[model samples]
Target: MTHASCEPARITEPDLIAIRDDLASREPIFHRPEWGSTRADFERMIAEGFWETGASGRRYSRAFVLDELERRYASPPLDDDWESCDFHCQRLAADIYLLTYSLRQGARETRRSTIWQRAGSDWKIVFHQGTIVQDA
Candidate 1:
């Protein structure tokens, strides 16, 4: 007989639940319609210096990402379902935080991280990266 088991995913640190919940709801970034569906709206959520490293290991700049997002939003996909779990957050500085989680889109899965900075009551995206999980 063969048996298989996997270790448990990380739990969100109790101290960071409030911040983690707030950010998790908006993660996988442009998926939540309630958050905002327009490019201008997205532009407001990300910092001027925002950037990302895709699961492909390619770097994307603020302008490039926004432009690509604008194009995708023009005619949104019908099957846009994705799920995120195992969120964990840490304070990077005063009002700055780092959030990490696992994201699954259909069969594709990746580990994601985002840096956020809070200005007053609003959070702005600073940096984000997604690395493909092998043998998942």
Candidate 2:
């Protein structure tokens, strides 16, 4: 049997735009991890208080966010397929974004946003927040 060599999928501008729109609109159905990871645990974390926004409008804890994403959201078999872009930056090359979505039991959409910073060759998350855009 001959084996076929696999190629990586390329990300494009439209893809980025779609991702931005999805997050901005809170369309949770399409939000999944880029690495094909699961988000069940992240969803749970959000359900809890790990990803909550306080009255001060600031996130409660970055440690909770990092831990949840790295350990749970980015795990195998689940596959988080979310996407994002640096729309606020003057140049796309200097801006970065991370986005995700979660739905309520009734299938309502909630979008998550995380601003990223480039460190060497990897993108590190500098900020994370999410909002419920619509019910349905």
TM-score of structure candidate 1: 0.87
User: How many pairs collide in each candidate, listed in order?
Assistant: 0, 11
Tens digits of lDDT, candidate 2, 75-100:
35364444432322211355455554
- Global lDDT for candidate 2? 0.43
Give candidates' CA RMSD values in order.
3.7, 14.3
Candidate 2 stretches greater than 4 Å from native: 1-58, 69-106
Best by TM-score: 1
Error (Å) of candidate 1 at residue 110 is 0.2
Model 1 segments more than 4 A misplaced:
1-11
Candidate 1 has which clashing residue pairs, if any? Answer: none
TM-score of each: 0.87, 0.37
